[model samples]
Target: MCKNIQLLNDDFLQDPYRDYAHVREECPVYWHEATAYWWLTRYDDVHFALRQPQFKSARLHALFDGIAPERLSRFTPLTRLLESRLLLTDGANHQRLRSLISTAFAPRHMDLIRPVIRQVIEDLLGEMQGRTSVEFIREFADPLPSRVITRILGLPAEHYEQFKSWTNDIYQFMGVSPVDRTTRAEIASTAAVEIERYLDRQLDDCAVGGGPNLLSVLKSASEAGERLSRTEIIANVVGLLNAGHETTTNLLGNGMYLLLTHAEQAQLLSHDRSLWPSFVEEVLRYESPVQIIARQLSEATEMHGVPLPAGANVLLFLGAANRDPRLFWQANQFDIQRQGARHLAFGFGPHFCIGAALARMITVEAFACLSKVWRSPRLAVTPRWRSYPVFRGLVDLQLHVTWQ
Candidate 1:
């Protein structure tokens, strides 16, 4: 319980960068008694924790065992499903899962899907023809990724709205610290079961030689003697659907927020389409969609001269690391042209985002379309951010855009 360190408060929520900067400068690795976890704020420390083998990601099982013992039985199906997800595992299992899933999300696959993504973007923007103002999150940011992922998963187009709702409920459990763990877990488990059943049905159909969707790819890999199990397939499909939808949705929303606030950078990018790639990277670095990631220490270790015992939960603040002055010059500034803007927005090492390519492709095309079709897009009202500690995304971005 460090008196000087405080998160989970309004100030931190409103401007987390300021709090993160202070922590990086004052105490790089401080223990928060309130949350019962160690905070890693500096760039080097967070980076090391992410890549270090000793900091394991497979502790969620143990973590939940301690948090809600009464609800454990009810959550077993969901827990087992999550444990089978590639993101929650490490080492050999993680590698195997990643390799199998990578086939469906390969760079070449993303390239092949680029035209489809562009068409979706064009159709979305086209729908805004007679609009003076639009709720960007609903109209464009949120729906784009949801629709794209649903299409990729070979789900019915009519189910896109339901898919988005399910993913949102799951994210509410996954991303935020819930006040009532019992209730949240119950709701999330319900969603997880529904998703699993749907995916399970899809897998059954794909097993009988269905279309060439992501589920079919995973099914083929499994039948071809891969170590992937049916449970793992269902869990990872749920993972892919959630990851594919939520993060990209946030990226588009946050990127537009950054560009709108930094008028000069927006103007620069609007005039020069070539900078969209770098601009996308800058948006990732500036206001990373996924902010905090947690890791458990596998062995007793010393970081910044502070001894930490094995099994200690460490929260690596990726958002803080991205803005660490040691890593980026003028870290707080949003300069798209800034060279060497390497960041951990998608994380690092073995656990880097599997859909990074797809997310970037979606974002790049999003900005390209906006640059071409929208003129002087500005915030129509003050934007509201979602109150999730781990995810930094806007609830809605109302904007006034003139048709070009």
Candidate 2:
């Protein structure tokens, strides 16, 4: 049953949906021996697992033992920071941190940044004016959210390039294979240490002279007058800086790819302005920015009649769940008009991405601007896909643009 479910298969990497279809139909809750993680593909199973407390997010500790046990000391900085992130915490700790930081993403704050988002998009398009062929990821998709994130965090926009380098180092370790992880972890640890020290200074400055930024927002945030510690604040900020732009970058690149490939569907948005929201939703569902997320079972549990042992890791295939025919009609087809069950692209339950609203707004503004400015955009060459199983995005996309 699991013969066709090869996670590292070349054909599977190119188009995972085909393999996902096979697994979802044949073995919705199958074990992947190579990775030693239970694969959950059905929408209900994935959704249920995400909400249950037993399926804990705090699983990074296993990375140390599983990857390179002797290299534990080397990954100290990286592991320490990662383990503190709200994304990896649960229960009261996760709630407290999520609530405090969520103030920065409140609708009011996002509303204030709407014009800024549009301006960034316009400026990026402006830069594309002379070029007939534009590398969409590097020239536009990557920088848009980087600029936005820096603005939201009140950091100097000039530091974005450096920030990207640091975050990519960390991301590489998180996504790379075990064979390469030890080296990646060392690089990631160095990057983490540097970023932490940088954030420490920023936090000090914020404490002394408060500003209208995420740091300030977090500083003042309190739950029942209980506040975030200095370490907790810095750790979550690291998460923000990394997650804030990374997913948005994927959304833009992925959405653009879909739009370029599906000409008729792409044109539908221009004719009917109302389709913008659904367009974004469909983009998220069709080619989710975050393809897979993991949760370790805190204790033994049963899922879909399968008994999972304690401490078992389950890989929730959000991409597969989004395309599950059980919930969505003609699930594999890309149709903005079709809407029934909501997509788990941002995930479901407590760990649902808090920056989702900001991501959606950025995507809407971006495509809206591109529609008006690019005139007619089409793929210049076959886009290169990032091979990581956890995140779905293009490495680079070249677009043949008729600049308006």
Candidate 3:
């Protein structure tokens, strides 16, 4: 039954939670022949797999090395960039990169940025005033994070539009089922070069007595005896830019979709604003922005009585793990009030998302603002989900919102 699961197909993209539920029940540890990866759907399996030393994130370099030269040539730049990203490395290299980058992304710094995030949200909401219908993704969801992240990174406000485009291109190359790998690679490579150059200029500027933003903070860390090379700095800055906005954008869009569809839940939260944080958590569990996380086996192992060979690619279905009935009561049902269990939306263990705090802050503020301003917001049209296999988000979320 698991062998037949087509994760990249339209049916799966349209409705993966239902399929994942079926797979989790029938075969928790399933091998996907099409993509040549093992799919782990159960909560315990995925939770353990993430922290297991044998399942490594840095194996992509080895995996790509075995592919045909012609096929691999196009991905050279992307692979190189991925190799540098903290998310794709392991062991000492991963630690070094993560530690250096962590300074700029510290929780205290994120808290300091809260006021600015609130202002950004306010400005975005202000634009929607007097409007009966608005496209949530473009008007609110997209710009809020994009603007905030750009400001945090010290990038000029004028480049926000370009930054969004570049990040989208980069994500396409990194997507689970990208449309036309050749095209995506070209766009991603070009964007990579341009973004790196931009970061280089920022680094140069920060070298002369740093300023207030993240780039300056990173520079301070570098000057304070950290062994961060220029390439590592560029890689992390690019990583932060891409990782910073995309997931949060999806979270906001997916959250709104959940709220609008579950009108009772929306009304409940609107009246009681204190539930916004819990509502965000439930939205993450219900429709995780990132549907899957990849790992590669370092050695032969048996998981859940199923034997897996060495060098095997593994896909941890976070979307499924979050919905596993064993973990949460009424897992399939979206309940903002439910609490206790932590979801894998920001992932788990050592490689947990560094931007989780910032994402949470932005989401809490966004929801708080929406609940206060928007009255009886309902879906204007059926939400169109993006077709990326690993990302669960709406392409456009049109809502008919009555201003309070």
In order of listing, the candidates' clash counts read 0, 0, 0
Candidate 1 off by > 4 Å: 1-3, 62-70, 207-212
**lDDT scores in order:** 0.82, 0.83, 0.82
* lDDT at 227, model 1: 74
Q: What is the lDDT of candidate 1?
A: 0.82
* Candidate 1: tens digits of C-alpha lDDT, residues 1-404: 23465566767776798778878888888988888889998888888898899999997664454355665898877787788888789999999999998888876556667777887887888888879899999899987987787777677678777776776676666654646766777787898888777778767865433433677777887888867898888888778877778789899999999988998998787678899999999999998898998888889999989999998989999999999988799999999999874899999999999989889989998988788788788898888777676888998999988988
**Residue 380 deviation, candidate 3, in Å?**
1.1
Model 3 ranges off by over 4 Å: 1-3, 62-78, 207-212
Candidate 1 has which clashing residue pairs, if any?
A: none
Tell me the TM-score of model 3. 0.93
TM-score per candidate: 0.94, 0.94, 0.93
lDDT for 369 (candidate 2) = 75
lDDT of 3 by residue, 1-404 (tens): 65487766888888887788888988888877788788999999999998888889886554344345677776666666777888888888898888988888787677668988988998988888899999999899988888888788777778778877776788667765434656667778888777777778878875333233888877777778868877777777778867867689999999989987898898788688788999999989999988898998889999889999998889999999999989999998999999778899888877899988888899999988888788888888997788787778899988898998
lDDT of 2 by residue, 166-277 (tens): 8778876776377776777889999999988887787667641333377767767732375777678777877886887878999999999888788889778879988988
**Residue 236 lDDT, candidate 1, scale 0-100:** 84
